[model samples]
Target: MNSLYHGSELCEVDADGNVAVPAFLEDAFAPETSPEIVVAKHQADDCLIGYGRAHLSTLAERAERRRVAEEERGEEARSHYRRMRGTFGLSERIKRDGRGLRIPPAMRHLGRIDDLALFVGAGDSFEIWNPQLALESDDEHFRALAEFRLRMRGTKTAGVH
Candidate 1:
């Protein structure tokens, strides 16, 4: 149900490994018949994250601004850049059509995605996963969210005089 970046879709990959785009999502895409998509394997998990080229551009701009700001604070942003380069280097630009998308063989192998695929919404992008891995990741994601909230609260409390 997370529509921010992903839609709730359980699509089956046909023999050709093509996944059909859900009508709701397909209708929401830009007018361009084929948009560039960047598919990456999650560094910490067994899933793939897809980033529309448009989204990736915007993200890069935002990240650059943040990196400059971090630089002023004498904080190293190189690690973040390294992670991004690693992911983007492994990414392939695939044409997205109304039918859905064709997961390149390399990306599929990188994520261990075989037949059944699940698309889950991410804030700025969406993730693709095999059903079982998706389910396991959901549990992990939920648990991480809780711990993250607690960590934030602790940081805020400690900052207060």
Candidate 2:
């Protein structure tokens, strides 16, 4: 099972732009043979996004499936095919230098990354953000989260009394 990346960790982007992958989430990058990760721009927000090897594979598979389906459909499906294909791809491996992993330049600009960054663990993936932006986003995220929790308060789980 994959562990989710959550919570905030204070991390510094080194002089070479490398940052350490939090030990807690390292397990998600298992199957050590495949050390490469996929970093993309967050679709909904300004953040450097990280996806595990397995997750990236799954995404690629899905996109291929869409392409096949679209080919059988019509030109209308071309746009959908393009959208899916454009979304995800493999990223550079996290480099080691006795310091940390080096973030790629493309990801840096996409996430608006700076010297100070926040690594946020999301299920199956992680997000990197500028410290200030992360803080501001968290406020809005949590506010909406509270409302969502309130809406779910009465929901019952099979294991819960």
Q: Candidate 2 lDDT, tens digit per residue, 1-161?
A: 44467664557677557887766556555545356666777766667777765576676777778777877876477676556644653244454334257788767877777775667677767877775564445477743443333234443223223
Q: What is the C-alpha RMSD of each candidate to the true structure, in Å?
A: 10.9, 9.5
> Which portions of model 2 miss their true places by more than 4 Å?
1-3, 31-33, 64-75, 78-82, 89-99, 138-161
Among the numbered candidates, top lDDT falls to 1
Worst 10 residues of 2 by lDDT: 151-160
Clashing pairs in 1: 6-121
Off by over 4 Å in 1: 1-6, 138-161
Kindly state the number of residue pairs that clash in model 2.
3
Model 1 over residues 41-148: C-alpha lDDT tens digits?
Answer: 876778788766666667577667877888898988886687667566878888776577898898888877777666666676777776555444458764343344
lDDT of 1 at 160: 23
Candidate 1: Cα lDDT at 4: 45
